[model samples]
Target: MDEYVQLLADLTEAGALGEEWRGAFERAPRSAFIPDTVWAPDDDAPTGYERVTKADAPDAWWSLVNTDGVVVTQVDDGRADGPGIATSSASMPSLVATMLRHLDVRDGHKVLDVGTGTGWTSALLCGRLGDDRVTTVEVDPAIAAEAALRLAAAGFAPERVVGDGLAGWSCAAPYDRIHSTAAVRRVPSAWIEQTRPGGIIVTPWGTPYANAGLLHLMVGRPGEPSHGRFVANVSFMWMRAQRPHAVVEPVGVSDHRGPSAMDPELALEDVNAAFAIGLRVPGVRYEHVWDDADPSGTYRMQLSDGAGSWASVRHTAWDAEDAVHQSGARRLWDEITSARLWWLEEGKPDLHRFGVTIALDGAQSVWLDDSGNPVA
Candidate 1:
């Protein structure tokens, strides 16, 4: 069987591809949107990616395009001197299907597809809801131009715009559904403002500590807060403007040293704990450092606010309690520990139990179970 057929079968078995989107997926084959040159993950490579071209390795290129994994199409924002960080990509097929499923679009419903990327998603939306009803936007001019060309080649042409996706396309204001391929640290007010009452806005939302979860928000009447819960766990590249600040390692003298009763593993082990901690403790980035030379599973969980505050909790196999060291004005370890304890007190609610409310003024309030019970 062909790669496309196999992909469809796998998605069907995995329940990621819904019947409503089956026809659209078939019509919009992923390979058509993928560029001839793509980047594949390689630990040995400088940027964790090694470039592969269709001319050099046709089979590898085809395999990458057909699989459920993401294909890195552009890196370093298409700059020559910039470090090779992934700036744009064709997201995983399963994830695309899942996002579309959450979008819950229907006939006559208009959609604004953010982060056009390779334009595969825009093509699918056009296939499902007609080209006229779909509008796609990309921040990078080069990516947008390439996507427009590919969309036309694939016989799908939705309204394409070259601009920041955070500012939703307002010319076609008040869409029935707004689907974002990129993740955001904060749900843009423009998205909420452009979505009509009772419409849906599905985007990946998360904190700097976590890349994120799929947010499915239902638009309320004007002046009311748009509310929604995280329906799925997803990690997409952050929207360019909203990407997290570069992680800075903790440096300099330690201000406080003490033994903490909490295990460092608790924060990283559970998704619920991580999500809750991320929501409770904002602007903190986390990393786990391990010593491969040691056989024991010993590591340190480091937290930094990227300002001056930093903390480290040493988890040793010999100790029941981890040793905590903190410096700079704020004690990040303390904040994280407090957040973890709060999560436990709340019965360790599943990540889905967490919800967010976006007010007309764009102020966001995260809650557990109900909107009245804020995460704070």
Candidate 2:
């Protein structure tokens, strides 16, 4: 208990854990939830626990509880031996605290916690609002069982369910607050449907092209889509069903045919333009790789599909000659160039000005505001 208190102090000083969050940390000894064989980045090597022999090595396990980063416990339905790929894990203590702070959980608020990884967050919620006032859901049965055991060990057991967190636990409807631990590309209708009209839903969201930003949306009418603004930048694994297909690099660039391209300076600008265009036209996937080799180097732009579409500019040290190749989806490149031109013409507005609106019909649109009117 003393060790846990010291750890809570360390996390509080680091701004990872708040004074209000200290009670939850004290109630839940993170060591009980974590497995014996856990990966510790602080140690020179990975550490394993002898659960049966010395199950009471409080210091060894407690040290791991305080480390940053998610701790992987089970993989492949908990069937794989050794440390399998961390399919799910208890989120970092700091991130958990941050999310809770954003949630603004009060004494009597009813909350729905989605993606109850390891039940640590569930325990925290229970510590705040009492066990009966919180309901948590997890997709994996094995993980849910482990989390339940851990929560019970901490003497703060909440209602735990094993099912798709995206659907949410409607049995506990009209929650004061609904928060998801996982990143979502689209806000699920079920979440808005279950939340009270004035409740809050905080989750990470982004288009296919950009990194995710934390979105704090207010629940609107029963059937209408929620509205929100970007709060902060965050990264999390997409929901299992929402994961995008693996991207494949293009093939046979030498065989592609196209017109002579422009100089490398223009090509660099074109790549930047492509990214900006993606902001306007979502689902356009592209990658830009730059190579350094004397005056002559390659600038490659490959589409999501394995199609070799690129524009290369080569030159000699003395500026004697330069060759170019422009191939595959020339029109896409044209659109990118046009968007860049628009930005330049408009004083190059900050990307933060862009906002998202989810429609009732399940279509999401990004708008650039100019005096309260959408520009693009």
Candidate 3:
């Protein structure tokens, strides 16, 4: 407990921690919510539940929860028997604090929390607004049940519903604030419909082409569309429905490829250029392939159906090759090149200045801001 307090104090000392959010962090003990059999990254080990075991050492687990970064708890539906990848998790303390600050919850405000992973965020909301004024929804039934128990144990139990959070809990309509811990490509209409006209809804929104960013929107009216601007950069697990199907490797492409002797700086520049292309043309798919045995590789970007583009930069600068295969309405590689050239001509501004505008239908467009206006 003392270590946890120190961690919170250190985070606050850094600009990342929010001052108003310390109370919630101090009150919630993350170890109480984490299951005994949690995934550990080392050796893919699954440590059994033991309240006083080394795995639960205050310095070890609490350090992870108290950081400003994310901590993955489950992956691939929690069926992972070992340390694999984290598909879901209790978001990091700093991010939680940031979101709470963005939420601006008041004493009596009704708040609806989406994606109650461990119910920790809901517990914090309940602490601020009272349990009766908070409601949280989780799609996974088992997770919801576990979160309910943890919240109850913390004495901040709120209404925990087991269902798709995409369909906002209408039973408690007209909430003063609607905040989602999940990343969603589409802003559901139900959220707009259930939030009060003046209420705020904040979520991470982006397509597979780019990392999601924080979107802050306000409910316009009961039947009207909500509008808002991108607030900050963030990344989150996609909503269950939005998760993509298994990616099929392109036919005639060998998984084994050789490493490129190309300059690391040049490779990074090209990768950044590809990202710029993705920004200009959303929904385009790309992959970078390299093998340890070889010094040659290819960067493939699929623009649209049947249009496969390949940019192969070999070990030698003079042997670099850019191939375009287009059988569609738009050539993706050309768009990428154009965007890259535009960036070069414009002095290559930082990517953080990019902004997004989300419409009522959940359609979002990223723009490069110039003098406070979207130029692209």
Best by lDDT: 1
In the range 1-376, model 2's lDDT, one tens digit per residue, is 5655676777799887877778877777676677655533333323332232125655655555666656655453455464433456667777777778878777888999998877888888888789999999998777787788878877877888899988998898879888888777778878877888868888766545444566677776756755676555566666666654443543554433343323324423532333345565444455555566732355455334224344433332212233333455543444444556676676664544555666667665555652244546
The number of the candidate with the highest TM-score is 1
Q: What is the TM-score of each candidate against the true structure?
A: 0.93, 0.71, 0.78
Model 3 lDDT-worst window of ten: 255-264
Error of 1 at 202 (Å): 0.1
lDDT of 1 by residue, 1-376 (tens): 2998999999999999989999999999999999999999899987788999999999999989988898999888888667778888998999999999999998999999999999999999999999999999999998899898999999998999999999999999879999998899889999998999999999999998876689999998966889999999988889989877765665566568788767777777677788989998889988777689962555788788878888877877323343777888988888988999998899988789988999888999989999999988
Query: For residues 1-376, what per-residue lDDT tens digits would candidate 3 score against the true structure?
Result: 6766777887788765576667777677666666544444554344432122236565656656555556666766766364344667877776777778878777788989999988888888876777899899999988888888888888887888889999999998889999999987678878887888878998877655554467777777644646665566677888998763332334564232333323323322743343444466555544444466663644333333223433332333422332333334454445555666666776675555555554557555556652246546
- Candidate 1 RMSD to the correct structure: 2.3
- The models' CA-based lDDT, in order, is 0.89, 0.64, 0.66
Q: Per-residue lDDT for 17 in model 1?
A: 96
The best-first sequence of candidates by lDDT reads: 1, 3, 2
Clashing pairs in 3: 36-49, 44-83, 257-291, 258-294, 259-294, 259-295
TM-score of 2: 0.71
User: Order of all candidates by TM-score, from best down to worst?
Assistant: 1, 3, 2
